[model samples]
Target: MFASEVLRSVDNMASKRSNTFKVLLASLAVAALGYVLRSPSLYLRRETKSSLGYPKDSLLNFTELTAEYGYLSEEHKVLTDDGYILTMFRIVKARNCHRAKRSPPVLLMHGLLQSSDSWIDSGPDAGLAYLISDACYDLWLGNVRGNYYSRGHVRLDPDKDPAYWKFYIEEIGIYDVPAMIDYVLNYTGFQKLNYIGFSQGTGTFLVMCSEKPGYCDKVKLVISLAPASRQMHTQSKIFRTVTQTFYRMEGLLSMTGLQEVFSKGGFSQEFVAFFCQLSGVTERLCEKVIDAFDHVDSTHLGSITNQTTRVLFGHFPAGTSVHNMARYGQSMNSGRFEKFDYGREQNLVLYGSEEPPQYNLSATTVPVMCIYGKNDGLVDTRDVEWLMAQLPNVLEMVKVEDPQWNHMDVTYSQYTGDTIFPKINEYLLKYTSA
Candidate 1:
């Protein structure tokens, strides 16, 4: 009886051990499944326009709209230099609108990680481009290389090749901006043109003057909104830290072929959706964080919608090349627009060691009127003041009184007309001939 009892007890213990193993395996499987679902692959599948927590269509109608499609047309064409085919859009406000016979035409440039579509926020009204065009100004929107619009015509494919993806604001300043400006001036039969840039758009302008000084003469006037000259003293600790971290990681990723992985649309869109979900939790939290990074006043948080928040966070910044991020880091650290240090500071050659040269502000003889917001985070008021002090001839410097106007508010905020457009119109009209 004792022997039988012993055998039965051993079997029971074995059974318990087996059950425990099964339970642990099942728990691990569940945890892994949850993780995979949240991974980029699964996230991409569910994170579409609908999944990003955009407002109901009916609700969006209530918001102030920018411009309609009627005012814009798209074309795929090659730029004069380097034969780089770029996506271009032309905006004509009036059929025969002519400024003073000598007044330069205006070319509008969008910032990094954004497309021309950014200028037009598709709801009820027109975007900045339409507003300027409607005010009787000939507006031409220029898309930088690698955004959804201007990705074209090179030996490198934005999708398949690392070379195509290898650029930052410096490249935009050196190649893309100059190419577009040349094309626009030549296409319009104008000798000099007015230039307006926002955020990275302004950074590229600085780059242009630094790398290609002759191009500055082609520009008659410049209007820089939220200009970023030296980013060493940026307001956002998070941006500073994150960008710095990414800058250091560029080498490892480049060697491993993971740099190009981010360029994939599937991965990008999924990442965007995941962030959008977080933004939806309480639009205020998201806006506050954005405000913190951008240096905007948090009180104006109500101005941004969940959709806009998602779009800006998810799609706008997108995947930047590690090399590009490193350059920004070097610029941030040095407080100068130097070429990205690829390991050697012009001494050691890893990739391209030539530090991007600093822009000569003295050469920017164009009549410039800078507009900045006190609450802007990306371009601090101090930087704007510093930039103004550097410029040889500044037509005017206007700081908006509204605490709500953020860096992006210049283009995307509803209060643009009340706080910004009126002032811009006042300046433009001063130059306009009756």
Candidate 2:
């Protein structure tokens, strides 16, 4: 009787082991099938780099890419007041410039999760940095702290110290922007520089202008592209869902010590590059996914061809802290452009109230030109109008004539040359002294 009972027990254990092995095998089979389906060569005809007309090399950094296109480039390091160090890039010579004298300095700031490379990623023809340089402006591209290019601090290490990644957009507005502005002004000997900001770039600029209105005098004109403020009316379903998820998972992320997302040399960017480059089908699918977040359709991805999109993936989502994403989530939840919400208890300690304080947009006295697209998925037109109402000095508000133009279109689309850069040039030319 004892031997029979022991045999039964042994059979049960073997049965459980076999079931687990089958499940593991099934998972591997599914993953392999998916990879095969997404394979570039087996699924679609692959296009060579020469056919695409972009550079043959993959993942070239900013200065190398600029030099590859026959443009002279220089790099600068900016030390912020708060111990963070940032890398700034400049197009020292414009290919098409024939003017004897250099125009006043123009500084271009990038949006969230991006580096200064965004300005030149689309190449000389459509890139605003190249265009501004060709237009005879001393163009300077500034990278915010915590991105791929500017991930340095005086004391804390980003990889080891939790305190190193504690900053949000407000810190950027108050410290990063001002430091870069001062560095550019002193370097160029220009009293003021024309500013062009896209998405989060626009938000940080507003924060800088509002918090330190004196800096307003240091900016001759602000060309805000897709001003990303008051995002209560955001249209992207994917964006809404993601922000909500991030908001809910903030505590979990903090507990797990996962402070950064899409960071340089991180898994997020590597996965993106691998998944997007799998095949033409996957590339289109990738575009569709971006469209889901930006509410952009296939029609709007005009100049962002497959090759260009792949190259962009190599540089994009450079990096940002989870804290910054959570702040955006907080704004989405409250539907107000306010300071970081530290919950009721912590908010009381930091802000002297249960609720976080709102940025005083009324204090922004800079000459501003607000540019937005009608179909932008992330930033609703109503929010832009609401922002315009709050600001004290709005010079002009120009809506892009293209009906299908979306958020990323402002920076990456070929249509920007005809649809936006002309107006940007007019404003910069009007405000600057040759």
Candidate 3:
């Protein structure tokens, strides 16, 4: 009997060994496949896009998405002084409102991994783009250099050129934002336009104002939503992990020839985009994934339906330089809002200092209003307080009234029109002629 029991235990041990071996072999096979393919994609195997590396309609832009919703979106290509060609979307007419003959031009800039698509993702009534248009403001959405919408350049190909990816937030401040501002001002024939920036948008604007004090005169007022300047006090682990290990991990990623991080071609991106498109169990999983960083509020789920969520993820994790993420990481470690750190020797050569210089908030002369969320994990209240203390012309500051409001909710909440937009439009009206 004892011999039989020992034999049974040995059989169970063999079964466990076999399962472990199978898992190891499967993992190796996947790694090999990913390496051979030069990329891993769930659907795309062949290269379809000819002008650039990606396929057309492979991802939709703000112009395309907004037009589908019965809005007239004009696609404008603006050339940056640094040679990048950026696509900026303008929503001059919407079904909800007649074309504004004399309304002010409002430039709404998105955050990290976000583009103009984010503004329209929440549907017409609640989406910021539609709401702004409904409010009779001529809405313009700005896309930064490296995002999916604005990936073109006169000389540098984002998929091939390593030098194109060398810029961080400093460049976005000095180049991208200024370029967009000039383009909008020139296009609309306006002396100054209203600026609304979220996260990195706010960061870039802050940097732009600091570097070129005269640019502040070009903006009537600044509406900063979830303003991400000093991320030192961020609560999200994902934000912490990326910003902290960025120096080493970014180098490894760049060495792998990955200029665009988690770009549209990857299996991981497709998988997440597809799975989040599903309802029931899949959507719940997506909620958990987004909530891990932004914090959870079930009421805010309507802004991110399956269809809209797919568009958001597909266009997003969009693509940016490894350096931009690294810049945010640098901000997480540093005390003051400053330029990118090039360590010691490079810092002296670049900024004539051993350390990166702080952005002069005193020069951000535009009347500013900051709207922060209580439950936001990425941008904390402490960080917002620090930012407020430094800036000279803070017009007003308010927390999202909802106790459960998180970072994502500031954009994704279906109730934002009811709760947030009234306040935003109030401040924007102060500068507008109407």
Q: Each model's TM-score, in the order given?
A: 0.76, 0.86, 0.85
Each candidate: how many clashes? 12, 0, 1
Instruction: Please estimate how well model 2 matches the true structure, expressed as its whole-model Cα lDDT.
Output: 0.75
For model 3, residues 344-387, the per-residue Cα lDDT tens digits are 99999998999989889889989999998877878888899899
Q: List the pairs of residues colliding in candidate 3.
A: 40-267
Predictions: Cα RMSD each: 12.5, 10.8, 8.6
Residue 63, model 2, lDDT = 84
Pairs in steric clash, model 2: none
The C-alpha stretches of model 1 lying farther than 4 A from their native spots are 1-69, 80-83, 93-104, 122-126, 260-264, 271-289, 296-302, 310-315, 342-357, 432-434
After TM-score superposition, the amount by which residue 123's alpha carbon in candidate 1 deviates from its true location, in angstroms, is 4.8
Per-residue lDDT of candidate 1, residues 4-84 (tens digit): 222232233333456543443343233322321112433333225455454333112111222133443445354625445
Better of 1 and 2 by lDDT: 2
TM-score rank, highest first?
A: 2, 3, 1
lDDT of 2 at 109: 92
lDDT of each: 0.60, 0.75, 0.73
CA deviation > 4 Å runs, candidate 3: 1-60, 296-307
On lDDT, the leading prediction is 2
